[model samples]
Target chain A: MKKSFHLFYIFIVSISIVVLPSCTKQKGCTDNTATNYDSEAEEDDGSCTYNAETDVEIHFSSMVGTESLVYNQEYTINGRKVKFTRAQFYVSEIHLHQADGDLVHLEDKYLLVHGEEHAYSIGKVASEHYHGISFSVGLDSAANHSDPSTYAADHALSSLDPNYTHWNWNSGYVFIRLEGYVDTTAAANGDADFGFFYHVGFDEFKRDIDLDISQDLVGSTAEIGLEIDFAKFFLGVDMRTENSTHSMDNMMLAEKIADNADDAISAE
Target chain B: MLTMQFQLSKNINRLTNAGVIPAFVSFFLLLSSCGKDELISDTAYNLEIPKGFPAMDIPLDNQLTVQRVALGKKLFFDNILSRDSSVSCASCHLPEYGFSDPEQFSKGVEGRSGFRQSMTLTNVAYNTLFFWDGGATSLELQLLAPIENPGEMDMNMPELIERLSNNHEYPSLFREAYDREIDPFTITRALAAYERTLISGNSRYDKYMYHEKNDALTESEKRGLEVFNSSRTNCSQCHSGFNFTSFGFENNGLYEYFADSGRARVTTLHSDVGLFKIPTLRNIGVTAPYMHDGSLTTLEQVIEHYQAGGKLHENKSPLITGFQLTTQEKTDLLNFLNSLTDYEFISQTAE
Candidate 1:
């Protein structure tokens, strides 16, 4: 009788093991169209991602009057000898327009273009036929009000240096940086060349540019190169007269730079 | 599902002949059957958010628990968290003062003075940004500053972790709170959980605004509210949100020349010079010596500074242009500000 009881116990345990996992109703992505679709899924999982529909590589290539940006090299514009020692700015809130006029976007990404850093890989986006790219020159109000230290060390928001592009939560980001020494007629403090640092900040100074360039992103990654004309930075205003602007207090200079930021780029 | 439970019980009954005791198996079966899908932290105490307040943004990675909060409260009040065991988070931030220092500058270990005043932690859970200059973004990450600041606790994190690991009760408490060993992530998470619980919403102002209790404030306070909300005064322009601040940095026309760069120290933008975050005024009555550096002594002085305009600076907020105010208006405004104090909240302790 005891031997028969042991045999019954073995049968019961075998059935329990077979039936346990099936009882729990494991739900997962079943649709193959979904980016995270699970093939082995028995039930539909709510977690489905279609991020590939929005990913695209954006490139901002700095230039000076049809000349590719060569840092510290003198470029004569109008009548002033100018050379940018540091050229950096933020490109944020990239939007790609679909044929149906539906907007696909890359949200909360602040891509900083540092002259010294040789433009590292921005991001790998799923290739798709897209209309011209539209992006803001500076961080949006929401992204601007972030605490940098809260982000990872490698994050764009992390303050690399307090003296330059690593802006604070209060002041927002430096929308554009064109700092270099120029041949000045009058040396203010007995200096030969007058150094200029034009820094633009604040939400009021945000510039939006929508370029007209169509690209077929079938399978391979497509690069959206925006050539920023260095000469365009000094279009309306003379660099020799308005030598430096370091604050939003100078609304005139800030507005001038903001206007030039629109025509500063040509998409390809 | 019910049949699965019945089947599980039957299978456990059959396990008796395998030499396992029936009692232990039954207990295990019962525990597993009930709330097996629930998260581990769900078994702990739940957060009680006050009515009419925004939901607390707790990090998904660090959920609040009873053991975690209790452990954090103990750590916050305990001096042993400091370098020499002479100071703590509570040392500068007194409970009576709405978890802030009434002193102009908070003293650290060995009487080393901090550059900025200890801010009030009341309703801190609602803040998206932390500190006067907005250094740390999340509450979990905010603990690193004071613990490592030279003018603060000055406790090295590695040594602090070693000490906690070697402590008589910390290891066991950590294991209960977090099913892991003593580590920095667990430490900061516990502290953040406890800090998130410091909700102060039972004040007379909250009662009036949220509960529709108009009689909670006097006629003077009501008049003061009008003045505060008026565009001419522009007090609500920056301090407009539910928690009494947008938490954005503003120059506020503090000084012509700043010894402390404030936000400019981080952003390195000249436009950010002398800018400091707009602090919540929920418990402004208790948290005296206001502003980033605790420059202003009293509310009267602060209001007067606004009334007399302020020293002109490059990055000063344009809204800060001074307005004329009568003595009665000033008194009434002060009365309104005092109504923000939550009597019950100040008296309550973790115990």
Candidate 2:
């Protein structure tokens, strides 16, 4: 009897040990301990202050013109001086990768740069000094079909506006909107009205290009001044040789420029 | 004293042989009850495959089990998907009318009409593209459009995630649907998974094709297919294939001025002026009024418009060089289009 009682006691003890831990797991005991420990330490140390700020500036040439054939530039296209009317594009999801390996992610990533809408501007960073800025040249997939109602309310995230960008009930957005009639309808003559209309976005063909800039946002002010060259938008492609009625249907030139972001003359 | 001692000894022996007796039994029963509870909970969402339909394009990322589909169905029908609790996906796309609205445009959070017509959700899985302009290439992306659209559900991703996470029921459901963490992608994928099952391939026309049921088509329907494929119609060029869409946008000569630039608006090409995607004619009988703008109320009007070679011609489709079709052909073509209606699709349920 004595031996049997000893065995029973041992069995109960083993079961208790096993079942107790399971009970602790169900109660989420570990999570509570970890969080409490962290909070208590934080209270004692008075550290982890988010003291960081940075200014970002984006510059473009002509301040106008849609795709190619600069409208109102001092220089002439083929021979005739052209004047640009309007130019606008979307820049969104500004993510800053820091040297220390921390990321300073910006909210309201969408920024519309329209000559009429004033030079594009967005600022504020709470993380450590950033190393460099990485952003999409056009709208991200999620923001493309974003609801305008929510977008207007959350302007910090989405720069989409119906009146300005035309988030039609159908297509998400016109990534780059350049509108104005060409001077003449001839591909060969310099005097003909010719302009480029490149609405490059989520088609099956367009590639996603990551703009790599060797910028150091470390010590000083973590600000980045980006310059987009208007001159190189129209490269070897002869604008004067084209007529007004030509199709900007093919986006090979736009793709070339987007890919040629570095080669384009920078205007800061 | 001797008798009492013997009884006590007998009780001790029983207890020892039973291995802690009551306590052990209690523990085993507890474990068994837990297992039994799991079995009861495992009642499959009871998914019913539509007749004559192939296996759906179930997303690799979000597979549709019964529980997930049931959860998705509730969420789709629930007003909680909206920010202010004003709308659901079913608000715009109802289940009865082939998952399309009776009105041309649907009202949003603030009773505002969306700029475009509510698209039909029939056989949406077969769609290679979505929306009138084919903006979203996948069902995964299409879920975001209505949820985030101001004139639709009007919910942001963060707020949406918070709302779902906050709900006691949804968190558990999300945990079950995606064995991982809960986020926008999982939620969107689940919704997409439910929608992918909404195939409209069980229509009368489908029966005729797959089941060799000649009676599925009336004489008018047979004659209509003839006119539809004829040079005078040029309809089959775009509305071809089993799913009934070539996935090409054409300038149906809707307008000369560019208010709605259609594909041109997206591509910035002058040649694409007034061009819009050619929508599937499947279930056309129920999902009307029609067209991207929902301008045409009946199939007959749609046929007549095409018969008249459309209104504008600034950048009309090269294929639409005005074919001369008799009134009878137009009537016959409309009949064929009506036969494509899939009433059973509108009424399908996840059993």
lDDT by residue (B47-144, candidate 2, tens digit) is 45555545666655556677667677777888888878998889888887788898988988988787677888877877766787676657766777
Each model's DockQ? 0.04, 0.07
Index of the highest-lDDT prediction: 1
Clashes of each: 4, 25
Per-candidate TM equals: 0.59, 0.57
Worst 10-residue lDDT window, candidate 1 chain B: B34-43
Candidate 1 C-alpha lDDT tens digits along B282-306: 8889899998889999988889888
Cα shift from native, residue A11, model 1 (Å): 11
Off by over 4 Å in 1: A1-19, A22-268, B1-42
lDDT of 2 by residue, A1-268 (tens): 8787777766654554454332222111222213233332312333333334445544444322234334444444344444455555666676766767665567776676654443455565543544456666566666665533234333633322422453333446555554443445353334324554545445332223334455644342344555554444445544543312112345564555445334442323
